[model samples]
Target: MDSNWGSSSNLDSEWEEHRRQMMEEDEEDDARMRTNTQLTATAATLWTQEQIQQEGPWGGSVVGRSNKRRGRALGHQKLMMDYFVPNPIYTLENFRRRYRMRRHVFLHLVNDIPNVNPYFRQTTDATGNLGFSPHQKLTSALRMLAYASLADQINESMRMSESTSIENLGEFVVQLFTRTRMSTFDNQHMRT
Candidate 1:
């Protein structure tokens, strides 16, 4: 009877360890699901797959036709000149003429697609009008958000350490834009 009691107690201990491991795995899965759900909800709010693909360098895992040349670094003087030029209308018009695309299309791409300025939300009031400068602000915000998202996904899927995953994520973001022939032009920073 004493031996039987000891064997039963050992079995109980083994079952407890198994139960604990299963619980831990289940908790981790739930946490991951919650994170994924939050990201999905955020993505649904702002961008569609088509917009993400066409708007910037990260083109939703597909390649598009674009020139494959390294861009020249713009000097501070050049950036200042471009910003302080005081001819938003003229500059936009000149750009449209050069591209031979409709001005409205350019406006849409800049304002809606990139929507770089963190302050500016989608405005229903402005119809066919461009209203922002220093386009880099908006593009930077978009890029950072994308990089973070991709990094998180990599960490989760690959089971990499956090720091390593983040470093890899940065490289991945750079490559995402660079792999495309149009990467130089699509990335606002790369545009000379």
Candidate 2:
């Protein structure tokens, strides 16, 4: 019974020592957390201030850059008004026959058409030149787009509607040559 009491007293003292150690660990953890929190807050505030400084008052410099960019764009648009062809129809057969290239090579060229045409005719006069009205521009843009849509059918790239395809291709260059000869004959007859 005395030995049992002695062991209980020893356990009580050890438990008190363990409790003190736990309290010290808790204090250290809290101090570390508060320091981390303060550092995080300071970093965030500095970042916000730097952002404000770079942005300036009401983001005036950014607004100025955007306005200048817009003006340059408008100026480029104005330059497109001279020597612009409207909805220019490119005859693939004429290109193929003229260049004496294979049909497959011609198709590749045709695929490159839409991208090239816009750049070539981007700027023109309002009178159906490059600087088109909203509707004309839209139509021209559509024509440019149609090249890609029709590229599949063109030069046997893919199957497509036959009637529509023929019309889109326009008359063969041979026919144009024949018509030119006939017109020249008529002009010569009128001169006689």
Candidate 3:
């Protein structure tokens, strides 16, 4: 054996074995590093095939788009109020006919109860149109009780959700109870 490349057969064999072992370890480390990098990159999205089909829900569930949703005009067309959902109750006739309540009584509710202010107040939304008004909520509750109608009927007339009508009825009833201090009916009142 040459003195330069191979000093002795035993020493050369040991050096070659060490080199081979180091190369194997380096390959294993590289594989591990590549796997870790891939895992870290995948952690950000973590999207599965099923999740991809679900239309990318971050925190919210996939809700169906409403056909009756109000929006800005298409090609500068005027966006008018729809046939349903009354906005302002300016006249007594209009107020009474829709909500089955007199204009003065409606006004009295708005003025008397502090909580009713929040329930019936006209709010300005992003589009600057008067969003859900207090009048509408009151009307929803009244109509639901008067006709024993479902929340869907209130939803159509008020342009809100069935859940909202149910919510309004619950809140209206609670507030009415609190404001009037009325609890259980008198035994005499319900006597046959």
Candidate 4:
């Protein structure tokens, strides 16, 4: 009976010591977590302050665009056809025969069309290469109208993407309609 009591007393002392150590470890873990949380909060606050200082009061620049060419620049290369004759596709004789117009008339159209539709203007890209020039756009439209060619077929020789060729074709039609309407019709309508 005395031996059993001694063993129980020993176990009780060891258990109490272990419990105390576990509690200390738990407290240390809690302190470490609080420190980490505070560090994270401080970092986030600093980041926010830096962002505010960088952007000034509100987002976007107070002044206008940084330069004249600010945000305006072509993003793709589609104007290579500006002076490309396409060997046999767009030769002088072929153009005249296919479009049913003289070379001079075609040239005149090319010059005048871009005056009305700014979409056909030659654009300089930021990296390199100028996007579709007026002549290329006009040629694309003319070929589409004359040959009833698909955008894919036109893109093959023009070096333009299919979507761009289609978009240019649509713009070309609108400009042509405006020109034809102004030229063919009287400025003042006749009163009934």
- Give the higher-TM-score candidate: 1 or 3: 3
Highest lDDT model number: 4
- The 10-residue segment of model 4 with minimum total lDDT is 67-76
lDDT of 1 by residue, 1-192 (tens): 999999999999999999999999998997797567456434533443333444454322355655322111232224335432555424665544543455466445456533433333423223443322323222233333544444234333333223333333233233333343244246546654
Clashing pairs in 2: 80-123, 80-124, 81-124, 81-125, 82-124, 84-130, 124-130, 124-131, 125-130
| C-alpha lDDT values of all predictions | 0.42, 0.41, 0.55, 0.61
Runs with alpha carbons beyond 4 Å of true place in candidate 4:
1-92, 184-192
- Over 12-84, each residue of candidate 2 has an lDDT whose tens digit, in order, gives 9999999999999998997797566556445434544454455455512353343222232343344233222
TM-score of 1: 0.26
Per TM-score, the best of the predicted structures is 4
Report how far residue 151 has shifted in candidate 2, in Å.
44
The residue pairs found clashing in candidate 4 are none
What is the descending lDDT order?
4, 3, 1, 2
Q: What's the TM-score of each model vs. the native?
A: 0.26, 0.32, 0.43, 0.49
